[model samples]
Target: MNKTERLLAIVMELQRSKLQTADELAEVLGVSVRTIYRDMMALSEAGVPIIGETGLGYSLMEGYFLPPISFTVDEAVSLLLGTEFIEKRFDPTFRKSARSSRRKIEAILSRPIREETDRIQGSIRLLQKDEMVLMMREKVNLGIIREAMTEDKKLRFTYHKRVAEADGNRVTVRTVSPYGLAHDEQNGWLLLASCDLREDIRHFRVSRMSDLTVTEDTFQTPDNFDLQAYRPKDTRSTQVCAIFNPEIADKVEEANSYYMETAESKEDGYHVTFRVREPEELLSWILGWGADVVVTEPESFINRVREEIGKMKEHY
Candidate 1:
């Protein structure tokens, strides 16, 4: 990366991490330790609110923010795609802000690049599936939950969960201390919270909530609660082995390798294994690939695939 990109990345790194050593930053950004020191000095000179400690490494001061800076075409496109995601799934209040932010980003770029970005943005479209569309229509007020989280207040709500089409569904009341929120392609918006009902941390699909109430009661976030570490670890998952066609190798690793455990070269192609949370979720992904991938898994997964196919045929 060039100096400008590296500088921006340095600022981003400091923002994401409360503290980082020069060695750690060099490893993450793929540069030498000396180069990291030089960049840190340059960023400090440029009035980035970077503070250093003798043994503790460097950090951005609390509440310090980088001013509007230039973005490369790829960076601009990335922001545009994220803004599109927000506009599509979030409430009208947030959607308006997303639109305005995109407009501001475009306004800052030069005309030629702006036109280029517009064309690239035009080629992008997000398909809101029926479930997500329904969620957006009956959307819970995320802003209220956000406020409650800010104030460390408890939230009470009835959550709806459906296990099977024929089995119907269940709604149960829950009081939770909101930790944070995350978005996924599968689950859309999810609220990560510590549930008093479950006596543990649970991920609640925000859209499936009803009769929502932010309580006057407040609680402190556990010092042990780390949102990044809260995600289910692969160590606790079942191992799934597969052979993937080489044609989609790059695409698969880039976009679909989150659950992957290990990948090895093979005579025919690449052999891989992923530690997955559930057979159903991983099976859906494998079936989406059709013949491009084949699963050689524990018989349990194979049986699930067979049963799902049987259901599909019976439905048809």
Candidate 2:
């Protein structure tokens, strides 16, 4: 590797341990003691807080970590997976940021580190499907919302919502914020905010938002705001039990991969269970599957499905 790359690797390796001897680092880098000393001097001159003694080798200063080398294997995997997912789903601005972040990470790794990263990349793969793509998009949107939440800023957007009285026309809304974003699997992306005018915790769908702008006006997130408590308590909050044909079990499994429950296989098919705070979302999903899936429980959910199907048939 080049000198800059080698120096970064040394700093990262040193940060991983308490104190490493010069000989150990030299051996790991395939270099001699004198070369190691020269490199150490170069790193120190470059403002790396490397501490050492005559007998001991070196250690990075506490609280001073190499940004690129600091991530654990799990963190690295999450970053890579999240970045790839965003690149596939988001608009140009977010896609560029994700690509840039990945490049910055790759530039900081040594040959060995790069190899380890490659292994992680090979171990996990996002099987691209329509639902997976949508999930990825939601993840990306959630990330943006989370960032805005952390900054405690207002977001301005033109929101589109269904207007049942007006032949399904979408109404536009301009909203501000009091807090961050929360993911409602049943509702897609939701921003928990006090509307600019209402000053109440209203949920706005991320997909319905356009021309989003994070404002400089900061607001305090209410300490009492709890997403779990705010959830709908009607039968809509009930758990859904479904069975999928074995032939399409894998696809079905991928669809609900983010849920808190597990899927088990039976002689007939695969049984999956999950909770939804809104039945409309689940109903839409089940209808999308046509006949490959069956809703096995929650009589209310079945009735809702029947009602929705009747509405659709009337329209046809």
Count of residue pairs whose backbone atoms collide, per candidate:
0, 0
Write down the RMSD of all candidates, one decimal each. 16.6, 10.8
- After superposition of all CA atoms, the RMSD between model 1 and the true structure is 16.6
Q: What C-alpha lDDT does candidate 2 achieve relative to the native structure? A: 0.70
Name model 1 segments beyond 4 Å from true: 1-90, 93-139, 158-173, 184-187, 208-211, 223-235, 247-251, 254-257
Error of 1 at 21 (Å): 55
lDDT of 1 by residue, 1-316 (tens): 8989888877776654568999988987789999999999899898888899999999988767554677787898999899988877776677778975765565456545657887988888778767465555334457767878888999998888643212343678899999998887767688998899879888888778887889999999989888887874233367888888988777678665556778876878778888865655477677777778878887888788778878888989
Q: Where is the poorest 10-residue window by lDDT in model 2?
A: 162-171
Which candidate wins on TM-score?
Answer: 1
Cα-based lDDT at residue 197, candidate 1: 83
